[model samples]
Target: MNGGDPPFAQRIAQVSESHTTRIFTRAQQMRARGRDIISLAVGEPDFDTPAPILHATARALADGRTRYGPVAGEPGLRERLAAGFEGFSADRILVTNGAKQALFSLFQVLCDSGDEVILPRPCWVSFTEQIQLAGARPVLVDTDAGFQLDPDRIAKAVTPRTRAILINSPNNPTGAVYGADALAAVAAIAAEQRVWLIADEAYHVFTYGDRPHVPVLGLSPAPDGVITVRSFSKQFNMTGFRIGYVAAAPSVIQALTRLQSHTTGNVCTFAQYGALAALEMDPALIDRRRVALRRRRDLALGLARALFTCAGAQGAFYIFADVSAHLRAGQSSADLALRLLDAAGVAVVPGEAFHGPGHIRISYGCDSATLGRAFARIKEGIKEGL
Candidate 1:
């Protein structure tokens, strides 16, 4: 090997590591050194996996479900997932390790060299990197001041190379939920442009207030080119279970299944059983969590608004606040994030990670008391000119 040469594939150079995970790891390291750290970096639910899921997974293991399974998914689980959407059948669903993997596989199967996928900014941290990993380019369109999608901007950004338009509702960092009209417009653009529409609804069930989540597939005469990706992690507290599925046309599902067959075969067999149990969980349980999170969102937003200009977080448990006011001269949001971690004992993902600079994403997924204390420290840190 030549001195100072890069060892990994050249494609690795096109992407960056997830800043959310990096901040999370740094927080863990700080905690290991006995420093008090409150992390609002990763978007994991603070609750445990519901008991019924645990019991079902145990039973599945006891029944010897440890062996290989169908590449598409466990038949029963696929059927149940498909049943959630009108006019969809099991053949249209492809369960994968998580929504992340489903998206990765989708990009791989759909993209070619120089293809482009249009998405609004600031989006989740992984979307851009995932697009680059697939040898496609990520075309980022700016949302309005309220972080709502502008279909006209998306339409303007489209070109011959555009292969897909990816959207997230009850979005990750900004928590902007797209209403049906806006979603339909984007879908129409995709249809007219002959491009695919991929909707990442991982936080679909997490919306609050009157902003009910509108499933992209639930549109009247649902768009045929649409792909919906959902996860069990956020809603059911199944992050470790790594169970998520993609619902699309049967042809798309077949292509993903062919790709997954050469990749991880099936999602963990027993985990799918647990996911099956999650589908049967009490609706009230999820409602209770949503209610609690709404309270936390209010508390966190109140605190954050006092510190910085904030986005209108209509859904999801995040407050994407502009911390540029708190930053020192020449300091980026990343620098401010690190300073907050080292000085304030609070960890937040910097805005640059999500293509939204001069801001930071604060997750309200922690307990109420912890969240209160973390914001208290952050307020003090800003007062001290951090």
Candidate 2:
């Protein structure tokens, strides 16, 4: 073989780095150079992890639970998670490093070459890449104008090779929470068409106003071929804990366990104890945080609407604002994001990353004061067109 040949696997070329993280890294570099930067890019809660959960994790560490754990996760954590969902037993749960790993493993176990997974546009950036990494294709469907699920469009996108349909409620990037009817219709499509329905409920607990998040598995006469993936990250402000779990039929759980055994083995041992404590945490504490986030959402949304046309976020903590008005003819959201970063001293992710090219996603996950300051800078930067 010629030394001139590239040495990477062809599959490695199929995916790109996460645009969100790229923007974050760039912001960090700028900050190191003494530029003041306020980041509204990454979607992570600003709150600290609860004291009870921290104490439990510290206890686990003190007890020397740092060794490798069961491949599927600790029994106590799995049992607690399974108990929350109807018909799920501990055997049906498989914990992983995060919801991301749970998803990657699911794709690896579920997809063969050339298979397709249907995703609604403006999805989390990793969905497309993860599907690609599994040697599967991601078939993207555009959501309705309001960024809500259009089951009809999804139904038309299905073909014989279709493998699964993934839905994220209280969706990322666009903070649109999917309606129950649309979710049920999509579920019906999956069941009737014999495809897997994967629900990524990472932000399920963060909804606002009259719109509460609906779990796909909670549907009465619950549809078959459903898998629910959830995380401890959002609920407990435990993002660094790296603990998330999947609930599916026991066969699927066993298959995932087999795949994970080869990959990450088990989730971190002490972290599982922390996750267990998260479940036992007081409902009032989570409610308090949700209330606070709702207020921040209002503050961010008001600032966002003053600049660009965007729907009021019903869930999650992002405002996906259409910045097309600020772009010159032929300019993209990526350019606008970069201009905002340099000119406004604010960091945001471009819509192109989520397949919504005319917008940018601004996270409201930071404190209220920081969010307000960032948006003010964005306004002035756009006005000056620096």
Regions of model 1 farther than 4 Å from truth: 1-6, 220-222
lDDT of 2 by residue, 1-386 (tens): 67787688888887898899999999999999999999999888789999999999999999999998899999998999989987778998999998999999999999999999999988899999999999999999999888999999999999999999999988988999999999989998898899999999998889987588999877623454899999998888889999889999988999999999898898999999989988998899989999999999999999899999997389988899998898988899999999999888899999999989999999998999999899889888878876
Whole-structure CA lDDT of model 1? 0.92
lDDT of each: 0.92, 0.91
Clashing pairs in 1: none
Q: Per-residue lDDT for 353-378 in model 1, tens only?
A: 99999999999999999998999999
User: Candidate 2 overall Cα lDDT vs. reference?
Assistant: 0.91
Name the TM-score of candidate 1: 0.98
Per-candidate TM-scores read 0.98, 0.98
